[model samples]
Target: GRLVEWGGTRQIIKEPRQEYTNALVSVHEIEHQEQKPGTTPFLSVKNITAAYGRSHVKVLKNVSVDIYPGQTLAVVGESGSGKSTLARAITGLLPPEEGTVTFDGRPLANRLADRPKEDLRQLQMIYQMADVAMNPRQTVGTIIGRPLEFYFGLRGRQRDARVAELLDKIEMGKGFIDRYPAELSGGQKQRVCIARSLAAKPKLIICDEVTSALDPLVANGILKLLLELQKEENVAYLFITHDLATVKSIADSIAVMYRGEVVRYGAKSQVLAPPFDAYTDLLLSSVPEMEIGWLEKAIKGRRMASAGN
Candidate 1:
C-alpha cells in the first residue's frame, strides 16, 4: 500500500469558513461573449422539449443552454438521463416536439432534410464507436478523403494531399493513409473520425461519448488532440458524456443533466467546486480516487447520512 498524505485534506475538510475566500470563488468573473453585457450566444437551445414516438416517449423536457465558439459545453448525466437524445435532437435526427435550436443567429430546421445544405455541412457528429462509424471496405484514405470531396469538391492530387495533411493532423502521417480501418488501432480509428469531422470545416461538432470506448491513455490523447484542434480551428463543441472527470479534464463549461433536466449549468471551475446541488454532490462523491481507505470512508459516511435521515 502506498502511504500518501494529502497535505490539504485536513485543512480543506476543516474549511476555515473565511468569507473573503468563499466570496472570491463565488464571484470569479469568467470571460466570454455569453458573460458580456450585450453579446448573444453563438449557439442557443431554447426550451427544447423532445419526444420519441409512435407512442410519444418523452426524453428531454424543456432543456436549454448556450454554447460559445472555441468552447465545450459538456452535457453529463447517468444513462437514460437523455444525454444522447439531446445530441440527436440538436443534430435534427430526433426533432424536438417544442422549442427551437439556433446557430449563428439563425434558426435551424428540426429535421435533417428541412435544414439547408450549409447547415448540414457545418454541423458534424462523432459517435462513440469509431469502428462502427467507419466502413470496413473503405481505406482510411477514402473515409477521410470523401468528406473533403463532398464538401470542397477537391479531387485527385488535391484530395490526396489534403487527406495526407489531415492524417498528419491526427498524428497518423501519410504512410497510414493507405491502411484500412481493420489495420488501424482503436486510437487511430478515433483520430480518423476526428479528421473526418474536421474535413467538413464544421462550425460545431456534437461529440457523443467519443472517448468512453478507449483505454485511459488513448482517451487522454484524444481529448488533448481535440483541445489542440479547437484552438486552431475556433470550432465549438456540444460534448456529451456521463463522466464528470472527463468534463473537468476538457470542458470549458458544464451542464449537469438529471432526469431530462439541467440541474446545474455553469463554468467548469464553478460547477466542480463546493456548494453543489444534492444530486451533484452525490455524483461528485461517486468519482473514485487513487488512495487508500476511500471506499470505506465513503461507505461509513453514507451509512451515517442514511441513519441521520
Candidate 2:
C-alpha cells in the first residue's frame, strides 16, 4: 500500500520514521461556552433512551446530563439531533422508553399526568412558539394568575398582585396584564410565556429554544432578563438550543449532541479547548461570521487543510 504523511503539503519521503499507509482525520473540533460554576445536582437525567413512533427508531441513545441549582445546563445541537426529546424525557412529558429521571432527591414518574401536582408545578417548560403555547382567549393576567392559583392557591386580589409582580420581573409594563396574546408583539408574547413559567416558581425551567423565535435585539433582552431573574430566584435552567452564541452566554455546563448522542460534555473551558471531536469541529467551523469575504476565507482554509491530507 502507498504511504503518505499529512502536513501543510504532502511529504512523500520514502524513508519515513514508521511504515504508515495513510493519514485520516480521526476527529473534529467542537466547542462549548458558559459562565458560573455547578452546584449540587438538583435535577439529573440518567442513561435514557427514546424512540419515534412505534417503528422502534431510537432517537435518543443513553443520554444523560445534570442541572445544578443556580446554574444553566445548555444542550446544543443541530436540527433533528434529539435535543427536545431529551428535554421531554427529563420532564416526563414524553416518558423515556427506558431510564429514570431524578429531581431534587426523588425519582419522577415516567408520565407527566402521573406525576403529583407538586412535581408538575416545580418543573416548568417554555416552548419555542409562544403563540400556540398560551391560550389566545386568555388575558395575560389570567394566564399568569392561573399558575399562581393552581400552584399556590393565591386567589382574588392576591393572585392579581402576584401577576403584576411577575410582569414587572419579565420587564413587561403593568398594563400588559390585561392584554391578550394577540395584542402583544412577538417578543412581548414570549415574555408572557416567561412570566407564566416563573409564576409557578419552578426550581428548574426547561427553555426549549426560547429565543430562536425573537428578533436579535429582543432575544438579547430576554436573555438578560433570564439572567437577572436567576440571580433573584436562584433557579436552574435546562436550555435547549442550536445557537452556539447563546450557549456561550448562558451555559454553566455544555453538552454537545450529534444524532441523539452526546459527543462532548464538560464545563465550558474544557469543552471549548483544542482537540475537538470530528462532529464538533465541523459544527464549530460552520458558525457563520459577519464579515466581508468571510465565507471565501473559510472555504480557502478548509481547502488548504484538506489538501494537506
Candidate 3:
C-alpha cells in the first residue's frame, strides 16, 4: 500500500489494496468509455431556389446555409418573407427548383421515395401549432412512441420505457402518458411534440415558430429547455421564427431573410449589432422594448420618413 495526501491538509490515505485497485480499474474503464463524435451537418442547402408554379413565384432565391452539430441557426424575417418556405425546403416537403440539398454528403433526390429511411430519420421537424400537428384521437404515449417504433424498431416495454425517458427529458411527468393531446395545454403539447421529434434521434430538427403561440413566460421556459437539450443531445437546430427575442436567446447564428433572399447571415453578435442593413434595422426596431415611449417614437419617425419620401 502507498500513502496518498488528502487535499492540501496534513491527512493522508493508504493506496488501494488488490480488490480496491480492481474496483478503481473498473470505474476508470466505465468513466473513460469512448464517445462518438457528434453528428455533423445532416442537412445542407446550397444555392437553393424554390417556386410554386409555372409562373414560378419564387419563395427562396439562391439561399444557401449549413446546419452543423449542436448549433441553432435562426432564420428571422417579416411575414411572407419565406422563412417557413426555407424550412419546408430543408425537410423535403418542397423540393428546390434549382440547386441542391445534401444530407450526410449525399444530395437529396427529387422525390421522397428516392430518399432512404435513415435519411428521413436523420431529419425531423417540429411545427408551430401543437394542436394541429398532434392527433386528437391518440394518447400522448402513442404520439411520442410512433417515431421510436418507426425509426428504432422499439416496441412493447422498450418503446414505453423510451417514451417515459423522453417525457422526463422534456420536463413532463409520466402522469400524462395516457392522456390525449386534447387534454394537455399548449406548452405541454409542444413539449410532447419535441419529445416525439427526439424519439428518432435526429441529427437536425427544424423548429418552425414552435414558441410563437405561447405566452412570454412559457416561451422562455421552452427556449431554455431547448438550449439544455441541444447541449445534452448535440442536435443541430434550424429555428425559423419571426420573433427576434427568441433568436437572441438561443441562436448561435442568424440568417436574415427578405423577400425570399438571405440578406444578412452571420454570427449573432455581428448580425444584430449596429450598422445593420435598413431592413435588419427595421426588424430590430420592431421588437417591443421595456421603455414606455419607444413604440410611439418609432411609429412617429416612420411616419415622418414616409411623408418625406
Candidate 4:
C-alpha cells in the first residue's frame, strides 16, 4: 500500500528496515542496462491523430515516437491512455486521420490492406492472449509453420524442420511440436506466439501487453527470453504495458501516455530518472512497495496533493 524505501534491489532486500519489506528478500530486480536512442529510427510515427466511429473523439492526439532497430520502447500507461491506439496507428489497423508512418525510411500506406507484401512481412504483432491468438484445433507445429509457409513457401519436411528449430529457440524442445495449444501452459503458449512472429523474420514487432497475463516468475522468464531473442535476431520491439516493473526489465526507451497524449518520452534512464512529470510521478508512487506502511504513506501523499490542487 506504500513505499517505505527505494534503492537498488540488493540493498533493499539485504537490509530491509521495515518488516513488510523483509518478506521480499528473495525478489530481485531484472538486470538491464538502458541504452540511449540511436541515430536512426526503424519505425517513426509522426504527429498522428486518430479517432473511432462517428463520435469524433480523438483516441490519439498528435502522438509521435521513434523505435530504433533491435531495441525496445515500452509504452507505459493506465487503461484508456491510448498506448494501444498508438500501436494500432503504426500497424495501420486504425488509419490515422493525420500524421504519417515511416518504416525503414519508406512511407507506409495508411491501411494494412494497402501496404505492400514486403511491408506486411517485415512488421508483425504478438498479442496479449496466447490462447485466443492461436487456433484451438491447430497443432503447435502447424501453428508455427503457417507463417513460415505463408512467408517463405517452406513445405513438408523443410517446414517441419524450421518449426522444430523455432521451438528450440523458444526453449521448448522438439517433443511439443505435435501437441495442441490446449496442452501447453500459459508461458509456453506465449512462447509459441513469439515463435510464430519470429517465423516472419520481421524487423519490428508490436507486443501488446504480452506478459500481463502470466505469473510473475513466468513473466520474468518471458521477458528474459524476449531479450535473448532480440539480441540474436536484431528485431526492434514496441512493447506496450502498464506495469512499471516490466518496463524497467525490458525497455531501452519509454513513452508515458495519458488520456490520448504522450506526456513523457525519452531514453529509459531519462524517463525513469527523478524530476518526473506529475502523472509519471503519480504512477511511480502508486507502485506497491514491499516496505511496511507504504500504503499509508501513499494515501497521505495523494491527500496532500489533492489539498494543494
In order of appearance, the predictions have TM-scores of 0.87, 0.86, 0.84, 0.91
Candidate 3's residue-wise lDDT over 122-221, tens digit each?
8889999999999899999999999988988999999999999999999997889999988998899999999999999988889999999997666766
Could you tell me the TM-score of candidate 4?
Answer: 0.91
The residue pairs in collision within model 3 are none
Better of 1 and 2 by lDDT: 1
Residues 215-288 of candidate 2 have per-residue lDDT tens digits of 76678777878888887998999999988777777778889999999999988777767899987777777776
Off by over 4 Å in 3: 1-42, 303-309
Count clashes in each candidate, considering only residues at least 3 apart in sequence or on different chains: 0, 7, 0, 5
lDDT of 1 by residue, 1-309 (tens): 653333364443345255543332222122222221125677899999988889887889999999888788899988988899999888899999999999999999999889987898899999999999999999999999988989889999999999999988988899998898999989999999999999999999999999999976678778878888988998898999887667777788888898888899888778888998888888888876544578998889889978998
Off by over 4 Å in 1: 1-38
Top lDDT prediction, candidate number: 4
Task: Tell me the lDDT of model 1 at 281.
Answer: 85
Clashing residue pairs in candidate 4 are 1-294, 1-295, 2-294, 2-295, 3-294
Ten contiguous residues with the weakest lDDT in model 1: 28-37
Which candidate, 3 or 4, would have the higher TM-score against the true structure?
4
